[model samples]
Target chain A: MRTILILIKKEFLQVFRNPLLMSILIVAPMVQFMIFPFCADYEIKVLDIAFIDHDGSRITQDIIHSFDASDIFVSHGIIQNKKDAEKMIQHDKIDILVEFPNQFEEDLMNGEATRIAITANAINTTKAGIGVGYTQEIIGGYMQKFQEDNMFIASEEQIPARLNLSYIYWYNEQMNYKNLIVPGILVILVTLIGCYVTALNLVREKEIGTIEQVNVTPIRRWQFLIGKMIPFWILGMVEFIMGLFIMKLVFGITVQGSIPMLLGITAIYLLVMLGLGFFISSVSENQLQAMFIVLFLFIIFVLLSGLFTPTEGMPQWAHYTNYLNPMSFYMEVIKKVVLKGSAFVSVQTETIVLSVMAVIVNTGAILSYQEKSK
Target chain B: MAALTIQKVNKVYNKTVHALQDITFEIQEGELFGLVGPDGAGKSTLFNILTTLLLPDSGDIQILGMDLINDYKQVRQEIGYLPGTFSLYPDLSVKENLDFFAVMYKSDIEANMDLIRPIWRQIEPFSKRKAGKLSGGMKQKLALCCALIHRPKILFLDEPTTGVDPVSRKEFWEILQTIRTQGITVLVSTPYMDEATLCDRIALIQNGKILGIDTPEAIIEHFKGTLYTFKSANIFSLLEALKRCPLQCNYYPYGEHCHIAFYEDMETAMPQFLQFLEDNQQEHGDIEPIRPSIEDCFIEIVKMNRHE
Candidate 1:
C-alpha cells in the first residue's frame, strides 16, 4: 500500500508538471461543453420551400399565404412553372417544392378529390422528411378551414365525429434539445478524461522505458496499476463535477436524483473506463498504439450509448452490440437520474451491471499485466 | 558466496536469432564484474533476463540462491537495474525520481543515504530540475542515483557509460569503485574496451556467445600472436596493401597506427615483413611490438572462433 501511494504521488507530479496536458484536462472540456450541445442538435427549425401553383384561385392563394406565415417554412414565393421550382431545389436554394394540380378549384367544386404533389430534396433525409410532414399539415389545415366556411351546410350531417389528440412530453417538458444533449456531452467528457489520459500516460512510460525500471523493483503489478489508476480516476471525477457545474450553468440542468447516488454510479463507470485504459496500455508497446485502440473503442462507446439517437430505434444487431457497450448502461442510468428524477431503485439494474463490469475489467487488467515475459 | 549465477541460459527469438546461447557466468559478492561486448553482443538481453524482466527459454539462474524464474519477486527486491536506455521519468524532478524509487523498495532516503551519498551530492543541487532538461552526463548521473536509491544487493548497469563524456565516464567508474567498497555487487556492461580493465573480472562476449572470461590483464597476457604497431602516412591505403601480404597475420587500424598480429616466429617473419613493405613501396615508420589490450584479445578470440 505504501508502494502504491508512492507511485500515485509520482504520477500526480508528472501530470501536474505537464502544462499542456493540464490545460487539456481542465480547459478543453469546458470549451467543448460550451460548444457541442448547440451544434449537435437534431431538430430542424428552418427549411426553405418554393411553390408551383397551377390554379390561380382564391383557395390556392390563401394556402400559399398561410405557408409563408408559418414559422418553419421560408416561402421563396411562387415560381411560374414546375420546372423552375425543380431547378430551385436542385440548385440547393430550396428544400421542398409544393405543386398544386391544375383546376384544383374546379375539381373540388365538382366534388372530385385531387392531389397535391410534394417534391422534397432527399439529400438530407431527416430535414426532407420533416419538411414534407410540415407542408402536409399546413395544407390540410387550410383545406379544413376552406370546407368549414363554404361546405359546412352540405356536409354538416355527413361529417363524422373527429378524434382530438394531445401530446405531453414526459421527461423533457419543453422538448429542449439542449437538455438532452448536455448530459450526453457530460458523459463524453468524463469518458475522455478517464480513458484517454490514463491509457496514454501508462504507454508514455513504456515508450520512455520507465516501466522497465518499475518492473525491476519489488512493486507488485497490481500495486503499480492501482497507483496509476488512482490519480487519473481522481482527475476523471473532478472533470465529472466540472461538467455537472457546466450543465447547470449553461443549460440549467440539475440532477433530480440524489447527488451521492449519481456520484456513486459515476465512480463505478469510471472504474470500467480506467480499467479498459489500463488493459490497453499493458498490451500496447507505445502511446500511438494505445491511442488508436482507445479511439476505436471510444467511438463505438459514444455512438452506441444513445447519446445522439435513441437506442430503441437501432437495428436488432446494433441493440445486441449495445449490451457489450459500457457507455450504453451508464447513459441510461445518467439520463434517468438527471432528467427523470429517478431514485436509486429505478437505476438499480444499470448500477449493478456497471459494478459488475468494473470488477471484470479491472481484474482482467491486473491479470493481463505481465511483469515477466516468456 | 556467489551473488548471482547463470548456467546454460539460452534465448531464441521467433524460432530464430539466438540472442543468448549457453550463456554462463557468476559474480562474487562485492566484485565489480563487466560483460564486455559490442552493441548486439546480447549484453542487454542477459541483463534483462537477470533482472527478471525477461525469462530464458531454458536455464538455471540463482540470485542469492533464489530461483530467478520461480522466486522473481524476492529476486526483484534484491536487484537494481538501469537499462541501456535512460529509463527514469523525464517529466519528474530529480529528487522526485529518487524518492519515488526509494519508496518502491520500501526503503527511505535516510536509510540508504550512505550507500548513494557520493553520487547523490553531485546531483542534489539540480534536484528541482526535470530530468530531461539535464545534460547527457547529468542525466546518466541522475539515473545512477535513482538505481542506487533502494540499495539493492546487486546493481545491473547496462552500458551506463555508452554515451557519456570521457571525464564523466572516469568519474562514473570511480563511483563504482566506491560502491564496491560498500559490499554491493556491481554487474556493468560496456562496449568500451578501456572500461573493461576497471572490472575485477569481465566476460568477453560476441554473437550471443562468451569468447572468454577472466581478468583483463590475464586475457591480454593470453593473446596468441606477436602484436606490432607502426605509423603509416596513409593508414587506409596501407591496410589495403597489407591484405595481400603472404604472412599469416591479422591486421587492423588502431588509432593513427596500424596494428598487426603475426602468427609466425619474428626471427624470419620480421625481416620478410620489412622486405615486403619495401618491395611494395610502402612508406611507414618503425614497427614496435606492443602489449595487446582487451580489444586485441577480444578480436583474437573472435577470429580464432570463426576459423575453427
Candidate 2:
C-alpha cells in the first residue's frame, strides 16, 4: 500500500508535467459539458409539414392551423397530391403530410365518422416516431377545443367521437429533453475521458519503454495498477463535478437528491472504467491501439446502455444486454437520483447492479494485467 | 552462495530459431561479470531469464541462492536491471524517476546516497530536467542512477554502454568498479571488445553459444599462435599477394592491418615467410608480431568452435 502511494505520487508528477495532456483532460470535458447536452437531445423541436385539405371546410383549416400553432409543428401551405407530398418529404423540405377527405365537415354534420391520413418520412425513426405522436396530440387537442367552442358533445348519432388523453410526463413535467440527455451524457463524458486517459497512460509508458523498467521493480502488479488508477479516477471525478455544475447552471437541472449518493455510485462506476482501461493497456502494444480500443468500447457501451432510450422499452434481447452494461446502471442511478428525487433505497437495485459490474470488470482487468505482466 | 547460476539454459523462439542453446555459466558474489557478444547473440535473453523478466523454455536459474522461478517474488526484491534501451519516463524529471525506483524498493534516494552519488553527481544539475530532454550520455547516467537507487545485491546491466560516448562509457565502467568495491555483484553485457577487460570474468557468446568464458587476459594468453600485424599502403594487392604466397598462416583484414596467425612463433616462420614475400615482391610491407587482442581471440575461438 505504501508503495502504491509512492507510485501514485510519481504518476501525478508525470501527469502535471505534461501540459498538453493536462489541458486536454480538463478542457475537453468542459467542452463536452458545454456542447454535448444541448445537441444530444431527443426532442424534435420543429416538424415541417405540408397538408392536403380536400374538405375546404372551416374545421379542417382550423385543425391544420392548430397543428401549425403548437410551436413544434410548422405548415408548408399545401401539397396538391400524394406524389407532391412524397416529393416534399424526400426533399427534406417537409416532415409530415396531413390529408383530409373532401366533404369531411359535411360527413361530420351528417353523423358519419371520417378519417384523415398522416404520411411521414420514417427514415430517422426517432424523429418520425415523435413527429407522429406530436401530430396525434395536436389533432386530439383541436377536437377537444372544437367541442368546447361549439358547446356540443358527440352523441351516439354524431359523426365524430371524441377521445381525450392528457400526457403527464412524470419526472420531467415540462418534457425538457436537455434534462434527459445532460445527466446521461454526463455519465458518458466521465466514463469516456476516464477510460481513454487511463488506457493511454499505461500504454504510453510501454511505448516509451518505461514499462520494462517498471516491470523489473519490486512493486506488485495490483499496487502498480491501483496506483495508476487513482489519478485518473480523481480526474474523472473532477470532470463529473464540472459536468454537474454545467448541468445545473446551463440546463437548469436541479439536483433533487443526495449529490454525494450520485457521486458515490459514480466512484464505483469509475472502477469498471479504470479496470477496463488497465486491461486494454496491458493487452495493447501501443497507445494508439489502446485509444482505438477504448473508443470502440465506449461507443458500444453508450449505445447499448440506454442513455438515449429506455432499456425497459427495448427488445428483450437488448434489455438483457443492458444488464451487462455498466453505463446502463449508472444512467439509471443518475436519472433516478437527480430527476425523480428518489431516496437511496429506490435506486438500490441499480446501485447493486453497478457494484456487481464494477467488481466483475475490475477483477477481470486486474487478473488480465497479472497474466500479461508475467 | 553464488550471485547467480544458470544450468544448460535453452531458449528457442517460434520453435525454430535458437536464441539460447545449452548455455551454462555462473558468477561468484561481488564479481563484475560480463557477457560479451554482438546483437542477436542471446546476451539480453540470458539477462532477461536471470532477472525474472522472461522464463526460459528449459533451464534452472538461481539468483542469490534462490530459485528464479519458485522464489521469483523474493528474488526480484534483490535484483536491479537496466535494459538495453533507456527506460526512464520521458515526461518525468530525473529526480522523479530516481525517486520512483527507490520508493518502489521501499527505500528513499537518500538511503543509497553512497552507492548512487558517483553516478548521480553528474546528473544532479539536470535533476529537474525531463529525462527525454537530456542528451544521450546524460540519459544513460540517469538510467544507471535509477537502477542503482534500490541498491540491489546484484545489478544486471544489458549493453549499458553500447550507444554512449567513449568518455561517458569509460566513466560508467569506473562507476561500476566503484560500486563493486561496496560488495554488489555486477553482470554487464556489451558488444565492444574493449570493455571485456573491465570484467573479472566474461562469457564470450555468439549465436546463443558460449564461445569461451575466462578473464580477458587469460583468454588472450591462451591464444595458441603468434599473431602478426601486416600493414601496407595498397592493402588489396598486398592481401592478394599474401594470399597467393605459400606461408602456413591464417589471415583476415583488421582495421588498418591484415592480421596473420602463425601456429609456430614468428621467429621460426620468419625466414620462410621472408623468402615467400621476396618471391612475391611484397618484401616492403611492414610485418610485426603483436599481442592478441580480445577481438583476435574471439574470432579465433569462433573459427575453432565452428570447425569442430
Candidate 3:
C-alpha cells in the first residue's frame, strides 16, 4: 500500500508537472462540452422553405400565412413559377418546396377537394422526416380551424387528441448535454491519462536502458506494477474532480447521485484503465509502440461506448459490442447517478461489471510481464 | 556467500529467440561482477532475470541465499537497481524521483539521505528542477541516487555509463568503487572492453553464452599464442599479407596495427616473418612482439570459440 501511494504520487507529479498535459486535462472537457451540445443536436427546427402558388385563392394564401406563423419553417419567398422553386431547391438554397394547384379554392368551395404538392431534400433523412411531418401537421391544423369557423364541423365536447410524451430522461432531468457528457468525459480522460501514462512507464525504462537496473533488483512484479499504477490513479481522480467541478459550475450540471458513489465508480474504472495501460506496457518493446497501441485501443473503446448515440437504437450486434466496452457501462452509471439521483442499488450491476473488468485486465497485465535477467 | 547466483539458466522469448542459454555464474558478497558483452549478447536479459523482472524458461536463481521466485519481496527490499538507460520519472523533480523510490521500499528519504549523500550532494542544488531538464551526467547521478536510496545489500547497474561523457563515465566508475567499499555487492554490465579491467571479475558473453569468466589478470595469462603488432604505410595490405603467411594463426585490425597471433614459437616465427617482409619490399614500417591485454585475450577466446 505504501509503495502504491508512492507510485501514485509519482504519477500525479508526472501529470501536473507537464504544462502541456495539464492544459489538455483542463481545457479538453470544457471545450468539448460547450461545442458538441449546441452543434450536434437531434431536435429539428428552423428549416428554409420556398413556395410556388398558382391557385390565386384566399384559402391558399391563408395556408401560406399559417406556414409563416409556425416556428418550424422559415419561408424564403413566394417564387414566381415552378421553375424558380425547382431552381432554388436544386441550388440547395431551400430544404423544402410547396406548390398549390390552379383554382384550388374554387374547387374546394364547389365541394371538390383541392390538391397540393410538397417536395423535400432527402439527403439528411432524419431532418427531412421531421420537417415533412411538422409541415403536414401545420397544414392539417389550419384546415381544421377553417372548417370550425365555417360551422362545417361540430366542436368536440371533450379535450382534443395530443401527444403527451412525458419524457423522463433517466439520468439527467434538465437534458443538459454536459450533465450527460461530463461523467463519460471524465471516464475517458482518466482512461487516457491512466493507460498512456502507465503503458509508457515501463517501456520508457526499457528505452532508456534503465529497465536492466530494475530487473536485477529484488522488486516483485506486483510491487513495481503497484508503484507504477498508484500515481496515475491519483492523477485520474484529480482530473475527475476537476471535470466534475466544471460540469457543475460552467455547465450548471448537478450531481444528483451520491458524490462518494460517483467517485467510487470512477476509481474502479481508473483501475481498469491503468491495468490496461500496464498490459500494453508489458507487451510493448518501446515507448512509441506502447503509446500507439494505447491510442488505437482508446479510440476504438470511445467510439463503441454509446456515449454519443443511444445504445437501444443501435443494431443488436452493435449493442452487444458495447457490452465489451467498459466505457459504455461507466457512462451509463455516471449518467444515471448525476442526472437521475440513482443509488448504489440502482447501479449495482454496472458497478460489479466495472470491478470485474478491472480485475481481469490487471491480472492479464501482471501475467504477461516477463522479467528475465540478461 | 554469493550475492547472486544463476545456475543453468535458459530464457527463450516467445518460444523462438533464445536470449540466454545454459548461463551459469555467481557474484560473491561485496564483489563487483561485470557482465561484458556486445549489444544483443543477453546482458540485459540476464539482468532482468536476476532482478526478478523476468522469469527464466528454465533455471534456478538465488539472491542473498533466497530463491528469486519465492523470495521476491525480500529480494526487492535488499537490492538497488540502475538500469542501462535513464528510467527515472523525467517530468518529476530530481528530489521527488528519489523520494518516490525511497518510499517504495518503505524507507524515508531523510533516513537514507546519508547513503546517497555522495551522489546526491552533486545533484542537490538541482533537486527542485525536473529530471528531464538535467544533463546526461546529472541524470545518471540522479538515477544512481534513486537506486541507492533504499540502502540495498546489492546494487545492479546495467551499462550505467553507456552514453555519458568520458569524464562523467570515469567519475561514475569511481563512485561505484566507493559504493563497493561500503560492503555493497555491485553487478554491472558494459560493452566497453576497457571497463572490464575495473571489475573484480567479468564474464565475457556473446551469442547468449559465456565465453570466459575470470579476473582480468587470469584471463590475460591464459592467452596461449605469441601476439605481434604489424604496421606499415599500407596497413590494409599488411593485414592481407599477414593473413596469407603460414606462420599466422589469427589476424585482425586493432587501432593502427594489425594484431597477428602465431601457433609456432615466437623465436622461430618472428625472424622469418621479418625476412619475408624484407624480401617482398614490404618491411618499410614496424613489426614487434607485444604483451596481450584483456581485449586481445577476448578476441582470441571469441575466435577459438567460433572455430570450435
Candidate 4:
C-alpha cells in the first residue's frame, strides 16, 4: 500500500506536470457535453404542400383547409393542373402534391368511394414519409366529419372495433431531445477519458523505456498497476462530476436516484475501464497501435450500446451481444438512475454485472502484463 | 559470497538468432565488473537478465545467493539499474524525478545525500529544469543519482557511458570507483574499449559468448603474439597494402594505427615487415613494436573464435 501511494504520487505528478495534456483532458469533455446534445437531435419541422384540385368543389377546399389550419404545414395555393403542381414540387417549394380525382364530390354524392392521390417527393425519406402520414390522417378525419355533417355515418362512432390508442410518455414529458441524449453522451465521454488516458499513460512509459526502470525495482505488478490506475480513476471521476454539472446546467438533467449510489457505480465501472486500458497497453507494441485498438473497440461498443438506437429493434444475436459491452450496461445504469430515478434494487443486476466485470478484467490485466515479454 | 552467478545461460531470439550462448560469469561482492564488447554484442541482453528484467532461455542465474526465478522480488529490491537508454520522465523536473524514485524505493533522498552528493551537486543548480531540457552530461548524472538514491546492494549500469563525452565518461567512472569503496558490487557494460581498464575485472564478450575474463593488464598480457602499430600518411591504403602483403600476419585497425600481430618475435619479423613496406611504398610513418591494449586483445580473440 505504501508502494502504491508512491506510485500514485508519481502518476499524479506526471499527469499534472504536462499542462497541455491536462488542459486537453479537462476541456475536451466540457466542450463535448455542451455541443453533442444539439447534434444528436431527432425532431423535424416545417412542411410545405401543393394541391392540384381536379374538381372545383367545396369539399376539396375544405380538404386543403384542414392542413393549412395546423402550424405543421402550409399550402402553396391551388394549381391549374398536375403539371404546375409537379413543377412546384420540382422547384423545391413543396414537399407533397395532392391531386383530387375528376368525380371526387360526384362519387361521394352517389354513395361510391372516391380516391385522392397524394404523391410525396420521397427524396428525403423520413421527411416525406412523415409528411404523407400526417396528410393521410387529416384527410381521413376530414372525410369522417364530412359524412357526419351530411348524416351519412351518424352511427359510425358506435362501432365497438375502434382502438382509443391512448399514449403517455414518462421520464421526458415534453419529448425534449437534450434530456434523453445528454445523459447517454455523458456516459460515452466518461468512458473515453477513462480508457484513453490510462492506455496512453502506460504506453507512453513503455515508449520512453521508463517501464524498465520500474521493472528493475521491487514494486509488485499489482502494486504498480493499482498505483497507475488510481490517478486516472480520480481524474475520470473529476471529469464525470464536471460533466454532470455541465449536463445539469446546459440541459437541466439531474439524477433522480441516489447520487451516492450513482457515484459508487461509477467508481467500479472505472476499474473495468482502467483494466481495459492496461490490457490494451500490455499487448500493443506502440502508442498508435493502442490508440487504434481503443478506437475500434469504442466504435463497436457505441453502435451496440443502444445509445442512439433501440436495442430491442436489433436482431436476437445483436441483442444478446450488448450484455458483453460494459459501456452498454453503464449507459443503461446511468439512464435508469438519472432519468427514471430507479431504486438501487431495481438496478442491482446491472451493477452486479459491472462489479464482476471489474474484478475479472482487472485480474486478467495483472496476469497478462509481464515485465519481460519472453 | 559472489554477488551474481550466471551459469550456461543461453537466449535465442526469433527462434534463430542466438542472443546469448552458453554464458557463464561470477562477480565478487565488492568488485567493479565490466562487460566489454561492441554494439549487438549481447551486453544489454546480459544486463537485462542480471537485473531480473529478463529471464534466460536455458540456464539458471543466482543473485545474492537467491535463485533468479524463486527470489526475484527480493533480488529486485536490492539492485539498482540504469538501462541502455534514457528513461526518466522528460517532463518532470530533476528534483521531482529524484523524489519520486526515492519514494518508490521506500527511502528518502536525505538518507542517501552523502552517496549522491558529487552528482547531485553538479545538477542541484538546475534542479527545477525539466529532465528533457538538460544536456546529455547532466542527464547522465541525473540518471545515476536516481539509480543510487535507493542505496542498492548491487548496481547494474548498461552502456552508461556509450554516448557521454570523454571528460564526463572519465568522471562517471570515478563515481563508480567511489561507489565501489562503499563495498557495493557494480556491474557495468560499455562498447568503448578504453573504459575496460577502469573496471577491476572485465568480461570480453562478443556474439553472446565470453572470449576471455580477467583484469585489464592480465588480458593484455595474454595476447600470444607480438603486436606492431603500423601507421602511414595514407592510413587507409596502408591497411589495404598490409592485408594484401604475403607476410602471414594479422593486421587490424586500432584508432589511428593498423595493429598487426606476428606469431614470431619482433626481432625476427621486422626485417620482413620493412621489406614489404618498401615494395608497397608505405614509408610515410615509422613501424614500431607496441604493447597490446584491451582492444587489440578483443579483435584477436574475436577473429580466433569466429574462425573456429
**Quick one: best lDDT, which candidate?**
1
Candidate 2 local lDDT, A1-374, one digit each (tens): 77888777888888888898888877877777788877877778889988998888999988887875678888898777878888888899888888999898887666577898988889888888889888888887777666566555455454356655568899999888878888887888878867888888888888887777877787788888889989889888988888888888887888898999988988988888888888898889998899889888888788888777667788888887777888888888888899998999989998888788778888887787742222
CAPRI rating of model 3: acceptable
| Cα-based lDDT at residue B125, candidate 2 | 97
C-alpha positional error of residue B223 in candidate 2 after TM-score superposition, expressed in Å: 2.8
lDDT of 2 by residue, B1-308 (tens): 68888899998988888999999988999999999998999999888888787888888888888998888888878888989998888888888788788888787788789888877889999988988899998998888888888789999999999888899899889989998998999999999999999999999999999999999999999998789887767777777987775666678889978898887656668888878777877745578889999989998898889889
What TM-score would you give candidate 3 relative to the actual structure?
Answer: 0.86
Colliding residue pairs in candidate 1:
none
Give me the runs in candidate 1 sitting further than 4 Å from their true place.
A157-163
lDDT per residue as tens, model 1, B189-281: 999999999999999998899989999989998999999999999988888889899999999999998999999999999999999899888
Worst 10 residues of 2 chain B by lDDT: B277-286
Q: Which of the numbered candidates is closest to the native, going by highest DockQ?
A: 1
- Of the candidates shown, which would achieve the greatest TM-score relative to the real structure? 1
Minimum summed lDDT over a 10-residue window in model 3 chain A is located at A151-160
Residues A1-374, candidate 3, lDDT per residue (tens digit)?
Answer: 77666666666666666787677667775676667656656567578887888986899889888888877789986898778888887888888888888998787666566777889987788778877877788787876676667554334642245443466865555555555556666667777777876788678767775455455544567877887777777777887888788778776777888999999999998999889988898889898999899888888788778667777788888788888788888888887888778889989999999999999999998888766532
Task: Give candidate 4's whole-model lDDT.
Answer: 0.87
Q: Could you tell me the lDDT of residue B20 within candidate 3?
A: 89
CAPRI-style class, candidate 4: medium
By how many angstroms RMSD does model 2 differ from the true structure? 3.6
Of candidate 1 chain B, the 10-residue stretch with the lowest lDDT total is B143-152
Whichever of 3 and 4 has more lDDT, that candidate is 4
TM-score of chain B, candidates 1 onward in order:
0.98, 0.95, 0.95, 0.96
